[model samples]
Target chain A: MTGVVSPMAAPAALRGAGAWKPAELLFWTLPVIGWFAFPENLPLLTQIAITALFALSLDLVLGVAGMVTLGHAAFFGVGAYAAGMLPAYLGIGDPLLGLVAAAAAAALAGALTSPLMLRGSGLSQLMVSVGINAMLYEAANKATEVTGGVDGLPGVENTPLFGMWSFDLYGRTAYVYAVVVLLLLFWMARRVVRSPFGVSLRGIRLNAARMPALGVPVNRRLAVVWTLAAAYAGVAGALLTQTTQFVSINVLGFDRSAEVLLILILGGAGHLYGALVGAVAYMSIHHLLADIDPEFWQFWIGLIFIVVVLFARDGALGAAARIRDLIRNLILGRGASR
Target chain B: MTILFDGIASGMLLFLISSGLSVTLGLMGIINLAHGAFAMLGGYVCVVALDRYGIPFPVAVLMATLSAAAAGVALERLVYRRLYGAGQLDQVLFSIGLIFVSMALARWLFGPQPQPIRLPGWLQGQVQLPWIEIGVYRAFLIVLGLVVAVTLHRAVGVTRFGARLRAAVDRPAVARGLGIDVDRVFVVAFAIGSALAGLGGAVGVELLGLDPSFPLRYLVYFLIVVVVGGSGSFEGSLVASVLIGIFDVAGKYYVPQVGSFIIYTVMVVMLIVRPQGLFGRPSP
Candidate 1:
């Protein structure tokens, strides 16, 4: 807790707390470049985007609000199921409409469960979250008629984007759709974290007891942010459902919860871009590792987790920043001598 | 009557496995999510010794317990010692990572299939009683569990080491000031806990089954035992484990439809209603 880099400490001039930085603008162009550079890997690219969004949702709660959870996948699964079921049960197949429905369903789930989170901290919080996730998973598993049980829900159909561009075999449309949604949500997340309300959330995270005396409604803020994060995760899950046109029990599994948390931490939590960077890095590594030995990829991921936690506490982004700072200092020293 | 008997036997097994977790989690304040993995290690050790090495059942079990305890000491010294002051998040991440690594390692060493375990002739078949007939193995479990429960109760409650452990748990700094080797106490307690888990895993193989996925499969059960019992309280865990074991068996037998849903729901409600657990002292 003491050594964690504050999310608010991002350079205002270079990273820009509220405004879009030039570097960020440059970062956004990579997807466009990827679209042209690697046409065959559109599906993988789309997965990275969706996962990034999921990691971003985690960052909102774990990194920004300081509510450590192992059950965030509950919201993701709720959203996925809601989206997948909409077309099956309600006959509403529009992608945008499904996203909206998914977000609302996840947000509702978050709001209902948020009170449980308010009960305690550390180990108790972890247990509560795990319990909630397990309960949902079991419920989903038993409701075979609806969820299709372990075999997964089939025939999950989604309408073409804006009723125009249909999801293609190569996942071209899905890629564009996923990237666009990720950008919009990432922008919204940035605004939310930069607002005065966001600052209070950070204050609560740093010192909950002191925040109450500062007139900050700690519990309410936690609830709101959690709900918002759930909505984001729901949207990401819906994207997966819409793009892949499938929903499985694995969506809500403990593995997903743990994987997303690892991805966020790997990218460097607290910072928005860390989610994006981590999703890309983790997914790429997973892709490579799975190709070699699908069964043992988790071994390497676990090893990476250990190494990162012990050596690189701030994650990839933090390490990159330190390197950049060192280079800048070297350049300044050279210029003064000249 | 059968359900109660079966439940109590299984509950005894749960107590053996989770008692160690209770001490480490409650006393050391470490959320060791990978505790089940150590139990799995013990189970594997027993299976390999019995099946491959032609070791007797009792000898195999002893080897399992000792090996797991040795592994625990090595890990604590090398990895866990560094994290004594880290945040719970770091601990969670590290332990989860450990789980993944161990699971993969187990899978590689033993195929994904459940390892075959053969009980000795003496431990086989059922024994008839006045009101009920119980499996010889289950009866053995109940007897072994009682022995452990009573022994542990005395060890923690009556021993000088137990006094030191309580002092360290209550006030680490003060305990150190009073010339107690807090670190050594923790290491010994941790090793003892791992040994119990190993013993539990080796013995419970018949009831719980054994596979590479053993750790994740039984993770929730062990956690429930510790949490419901109250983290650091030994007596509390014993009571909670039995309650849960009965509740789980009864839920499966009677409801048949709800499965473990009832157990998880109870745990959630317990956590919400009483975060300190049934017997745990409320945090300052």
Candidate 2:
């Protein structure tokens, strides 16, 4: 326990303080702002926004809670199916109610799984979660009469948000709706992470045994955190279904789960912004590479992963930090820093 | 009856491939998920050797195993070395990365389609068992797995090298202090693990065939066997694998609806009930 110093107790070194320049803002944010301002690009912006939120939800578990799950797509799938099937199967024509159902269903499933999952270490936790997802996937595939098998469920006509805004195919409504949801979730996540409970989670993640010794119910805390993360994932899934109006079996696939994990890793887990950066970078690369050569794209992706792991320990953020350091040192001559 | 025999053969092959993973994981506390990928690569290589160069089946398998072993050694030096004591998450991330790299390389070299290897003419045809006729190749596989298992059991359970390896595992730092070459031990263990994976891949392809997703799809089965058998217990892996194999076979053949998926759930239950596995030592 002597060398087991929690990251919380580490000195606040101001690692990225004042590093974001105005030009950098112009370089990144302006394009995004411009794209969103255009009517044609709304759908694309909305998709990115939703995906960013989903990645953020996964970050709550992998990043903040220090729980790595290989089966989070199960929760995502749960939400998607809830939103999709409620209308299609149960004849709940109202999309708003359907979305709430999706979130609530996923939250329920998460609550059920959290206790079993929260007790294990990373490997066992990964295995159990993965097992649960695989079982769910199998069930989803087999329950063809109910789930539509491999063909997927369709015909989801989403009502307008608050009955005032119709979701236009041009993606205007979806984009704004997604943006609002993303902002709200982002703000809530920020508040949650900054709370005392979040502090306790950090403490448990750093050293679980010590927390129990310090009177914290480590397992119970983990269960609650996992459930919250699952609820977030469920929301993302519901949004995906709502926007697409089609729910496929691939939502709960291992590749989806693995990709989410890769995004979190690439984005640098532990930072809220990491999930956003990771989703954007990963999806953009995937889009770019698929356009180049669908067959050979994985090769390039694999190479990038290798390079990221070998060089960028902190991933893309580390690269950004390095560039910032270089610019700062160049401006104030190396000899000027005392 | 024939179904039972076929299932047995398949289970034996899986056990052969997974045993290496179990041993290395037990001793080194390293979770090498890339083990299956290596096996898949071996299967692909053997397929190419037989199909492309018109090489003999036995020769192709030998070449594949040797090449896979070499790859294993290289992996140990390059990637596995960095993962020691780095936590399970790091091992998983790094190994998963390696799996992707291996998969990418396999796809690049062999393409994505399943490589159907033609068994040597001698190994073809069915064998007349007491109750039923079985595929001659499958029967041969079962015998081979048993021989390997027995030989390994003797090597690890009876030999001085096994004793030394156990000693090393038990007190790695002290073993180093006592002048044992710990690095060499690690390298050898990894090589042995990869070799087992290669061996498993070589045999399994005869029945299951070669595919890109082979490694990932069967990863849970392998990990479950290792965990249930208790890490570091070769005999336990054998016992656990056999039990799982029989259960899987019976489940698929008889009760396909319930048992196939429940295997993993059973594993979870077992872990909850006996965290150290049925026969493993309690956590220190």
Candidate 3:
């Protein structure tokens, strides 16, 4: 665990990037530039944005909180099902309430299962989570009346946000909404990582026995962190359902859980922005590779994984950072001229 | 009564698969997720030998079992050997990767669809008892599984190799200092454990359809058995498997809505309250 970057080291990397220091200035200026310059890329960017949030939510447990969950998709699936079904079955047309309900349902489940996870180590926890997810997926498959089973619950008509912003195919409203949510969550997560509670969580992750001996109440803190992470995952799932307007059983599948875990590890666990970079890079490369050769895409992806594991231990984002540093040095030629 | 017979039959199959996993995990501290993958490989081999190559069923089963044992030995040498000193997280991730590679290879070799290797005519019919009639194959499976379980218990409790394996499991460092071939013992331990998984897969394939996805799907089910029975205890797995079989049948028959989740919930509760497993003594 030593030599790895701890989540508590968020010392705001914005100490005068030469000129940009004001948070308000960057917030306003970047959005205007992005919206005006890349109007055509908004849809793709939006998908990446939501996925990035999903990955970040996973990192809160896997990376920061040190909980290796293989069934984080349980929360994600619950959120999607809640968002899709509440409107279709119960006539709750309000998008806001659907999202809230999705997160709340997943949070409740996370809270209930938190005690189960508190005692087990990595493999034990992973097995329990996998079993839980599989059972849920089977239940969803069997509950045809409620879930519509494998055929999926369709005809989910989304009421416009605030009764105004209707989701469009071009993803104009969905993209903006998703991006805004990601930014807000990112900001909140950053603040949380800097708090005293986050410090205690870090202590528990580092040395559980020592921390409990120091009066940390390690088990309870684990449950709290796990529940919070599940809530975030639930919200991300809700966003996916709302944006796509379709919910499938695959959302709770093993592949979903494994891919999310891979994305987090590939992105460098403790680094906040690594998840975004990992998700965007992974999805983009996967899409490109699949399009180029449908049948043998896995071969190339496997090769990429091996290279990343061997050479770039931190992942694509870490490799990119190294390349960027090299280029900066090459261009700048030396330290700042006197 | 027929339902009860069927439950017992299925419970035996579960016991066979889970007992091996329990031993290796208890002894070596290696979480071999690929154990099920080995089982699937064995099932496919048996299917290929019996159906495609016209081999006798018993001979095909033996060949499949040995082939799986060879594969297990190879895995122990190549992947697991490096992972001995690694932490639990790395072991889990690496084994997951191994599962993926093995499954992809199986799918590539034998397409995605499930294959049926017809049971011999002798195993095709049902046998009637005074109270109930059960599938002949199911009866054979239950008998075979019981024999293996009893043999394993006696071997581990009484035999010299079993004593050495047990000593290694209980205290590896001490065993090594006392001149035991600890490395060779681990290799044989994994090989035997995985061979049982292979045999279980071959025998149980008729009950649970043989497919590439079988390993990934049933991996956690066996893990639950291990957790509930307490890892490393063959008797515990046997008892737990029957208990789970009964519980699973009851859940499905009555509260069909929450069929599998009941077992999972029980596992979660057991894990939280007793991390050492139900009958397992806490590892030192």
Task: Point to the candidate with the largest lDDT.
Answer: 1
Model 2 stretches astray by more than 4 angstroms? A1-34, A37-44, A314-338, B257-259
Per-model TM-score, in order, reads 0.94, 0.89, 0.87
In candidate 3, residue B23 scores what lDDT? 68
Runs with alpha carbons beyond 4 Å of true place in candidate 3? A1-45, A296-338
Q: For candidate 2, write residues A190-221 as lDDT tens digits.
A: 66775656667788878877988876778877
Q: List the residue pairs that clash in candidate 3.
A: none
The alpha-carbon deviation from the true structure for residue B86 of candidate 1, after best TM-score superposition, in angstroms, is 0.5
Q: How does residue A283 of candidate 3 score in lDDT? A: 77
> Fraction of true contacts reproduced, model 1?
0.65
Off by over 4 Å in 1: A1-16, A314-338
DockQ of each: 0.76, 0.40, 0.33
lDDT of 1 by residue, B136-226 (tens): 9988998898898888888888999999988987898999999999889988988988888899999989889999888888888889888
lDDT for position A231 in model 1: 97
TM-scores of chain A, one for each prediction: 0.89, 0.83, 0.83
